[model samples]
Target chain A: MSYFVSPIAYIVLLVFTVLSGVFFFIYLEGFAQVQFDTRAQLFQQSFSLTEFVLQPYFGTISVLLLLIIPMLTMRLLSEEKKQHTSELLFTSPITVINIVLGKYLAALALFILMLLFSSIFVIVLYLKGNPDPGVILSGFMGLFLIGASFLAVGLFASSLSQNQIVSAVISFGLLLLFWIIGASSDAETSVVGYLSIINHLDNFIKGVVEVKDLVYYISFIFIGLFLTHIVLDSQRWR
Target chain B: MIKVQNLTKKYGNIVAIDNISFQVNKGEILGFLGPNGAGKTTTMRMITGYMPASEGRVEVSGFDIADDPIAAKNEIGYLPENPPLYDDMKVTDFLDFVAGIKGVQEGRAAKIEDSMNKCGISDVKGRLIGNLSKGYRQRIGIAQAILNDPSVLVLDEPTIGLDPKQIIEIRELIKQLGSERTIILSTHILPEVMMTCSKVVIINKGRIVLETTLGELNEKLDGDNEIHLKLEKYSSDIKAKLSALQSVQNVNDLGSGEFIIKSRQRNNIGDEIARVVIDNNWGLKEIRPKLNTLEDVFLNVISSELKQ
Candidate 1:
């Protein structure tokens, strides 16, 4: 709640709303041009809006979320430390779990709210095009899972340093690494490919919901929060 | 009540505080007296459950801090050397947040109001904490500490970085609050302890040099004020002359016409030293009694502890 009152939250929200809106219109126009080009071809079969438009649209939104979630979470723990407010929190009757979970959930809540606003774009799609509700919903779920995992990582990174910028950089480095490292080859059974965060998302964007993907995200979130709890508790011991 | 026994803290090989023991009963304020870097803050941190001790234990209201930290911390309201404040937060909002975390449920609004009133920050309750003056910020820091009405209150240098009037006001506020709570206030300022505390614990270089009632500390401070004397000429014979005086207790030559004269507080030694200088044709260049430095007070406490 304190976070929502700050200007940074609104600023990040505005930037996200603008950037995702622009991405939606740009993708819609590109899909329309492709449809027109296909109309000139031999076959007059229509193109799937979910395939040519919202899929790519959600994909770009993921990238946009990746860039902005760090800003939302960089100060969660680092600002508490820098301002010495962690001392206040630690001395209170609160546990390390409470501290870690409270911050993660608050940032996650704001991210969810931000995701809700972009649903207007989905509403517009429903009005104009006959898109698959299941695919769009699956894509939204993937974004939610990815955002949750990213937020957890960002929260953990925030605990690693007292400087907000340093935490931001660390989370960015970690997230980008997770996104690009095991993406070298398309081998489906590669051990390293399983570690790639983006690999799980492809199945979700294609309207496939694998239980392994859900487990991966939930476990990722758990590990991130566990590491954060250890770091915060050890700060007291040190 | 707060009980800290054999409490020790170390950062790697550096012992921040040695094994220390002390307690503050209900309604008594314990002054943690020490110079800067003397581990006063470290001990207070341990007592408040902000930092875990490397060895030993702390118990508050029968809850061992090591065994049950949440209960122990629930009883303690700590104001660290730098007050933990959210600079961008409104004063009321910050206090509300603290009240929430401290779990003040019954009559929460009234309690917040009373704390703000006690700290005299009610006027600025709606203002941003970053915009307040140093005194107001300190007051707000103190307000948050007292908001929960915890059984134990730990304040470190509460009057530091304030003007003289603000210091006196804060001292009065502390005295008022000490009527019920067990308070441990750490500071390098000696007179602050004398003004607001019932007991004093003097620490020097991470070790407790002395622990006693403030009344006893007052006596030690009185008898240990040494008069520094500087004459215009060398003083081989002057040391004996000053030492032989009826009121003077001891004299030590500090080389090159300088001497330290000691005497009990009841004696009138200053005029006698001057009279002796005039009669013996010795020029009196400087004569000043040192009384206020924390080092001076610690020297007396350490001497008494050595005797013990």
Candidate 2:
């Protein structure tokens, strides 16, 4: 709630929503042009709305979320440390894991709210064209998993510093590194390639709910949150 | 009750608080007195389980802070030197958040009200904490600390910045709270310790130099007692005659019938001074032993320790 109340959160949300909306309409117009050309030539085969519109839309959201998730999570622990409110939380009768999870969940809740806003585009697809419900559900699920993984990384970054800018930079650096790894692991099946979070989301984006991808995302979330807890715990000793 | 045994905190190669030990009995207000950077805040942080000690142990109500942090922390309430407040939050909302995190789910509303009333900040419950005055913020800090109704309260520099009236009000509130809960409040302010603390532990350079009750502190400070005397008539031989007394070590005459007679060690020099004045036909208007203040004792103890 505090995060939502901040103007920066609203600014980030508005920017991401507007950018995604513009990109989605541009893709829709291009797909409509191709469909018009096919109809003018009297072609029997129709355009797959899922291929041209839904997949591209999800892909764009994935990239946009990679940039925006850190903005939402950068202040989670860093701001508390800066304000000295970390003392109150540390002294309270709660474990470090509890603090980490509580903050992570709050950020995740905001991310979920942002995703709900993006769902308005999906509703347009449902009303205007024939979009596969199953594929749409899987793409949303994939977006959620990947976004949550980014938030976990951001959470860990937040625990490393009292400066929000430093945390945000670290988070961006880490997420960008993972995104690069995914892009670079085009032909390799090595362990490093497998560790790329973006690669794991590909299966879900293709509407295939593989156990390996699910496990990968779950482990990513787990590792991120676990590392955050360890950092917070080590702070007490320091 | 709280007990700290040989508590030591080190930052890399720098030792913040050396081997220090103290105890606060149930219902006793223990004043942690020190100069700036004297490790008062470090000690309080360790006791409250906000930070782990590099060495030694702290126990609150028989729960070891390291081994049983949750239970130990549950037994204590803490107010850090800065008050740990969220400036963006309203007073009521902030307290509610604290109550939720502290796990005071049962009767939380009543508890919040009670604490606010006790701290005398119920009127500003709806105002944003950042907009409140420093004194009001301090009270809110105190309200959060006492909201959980813990048996032990650890406050770090509870009255660092406030007006004289606010300081007195906070002192009175602390004294009232001290009737049931064991409290350890740290401050560099001398008179704050003198007025509010039942027992004071003066720390210098991360080590305890003196730990004694306020009553015994006064007695301990009587090592170099002085008697103040104001005479109506001046005599040339008054100073020499007063110094002639075995208990009188020295006489400092102020040239206007005002004199300060130094005693060797807690002697009854006031009676002797009175007798000397009567015998000399010099009218003695006022004569009394100059009591030693906590400030004198603090400076004397700290400087003596530094000298050693």
Top DockQ hit:
1
Model 1: per-residue Cα lDDT over B1-308, one tens digit each: 88888888889999889888888899899998876798988888888788889999999988998899899889888998888998888999999989988889999999999999988888898998878888888888899998988888899889987888878888998888889889999887877877899998888778888889977776666646578889898857778888898878888899989988888565557888889888998888999874545456777666775686
Question: TM-score: which candidate is best?
Answer: 2
Kindly list the per-residue Cα lDDT of model 2 for residues A18-62, writing each as its tens digit: 888898898898888988895655866667888889889998899
The iRMS of model 1 comes to 1.0
Instruction: Return model 1's CA RMSD, one decimal.
Output: 4.1
Model 1 per-residue lDDT at B230:
90
In model 1, where do residues sit more than 4 Å from their true spots? A38-41, B224-295, B300-308
User: What DockQ do you compute for every candidate structure?
Assistant: 0.70, 0.66
* Quality of model 1 by C-alpha lDDT: 0.86
Tens-digit per-residue lDDT, A53-142, candidate 1: 888988898898889988888999999877778889989998888888889988989999889888789888988889999888899899
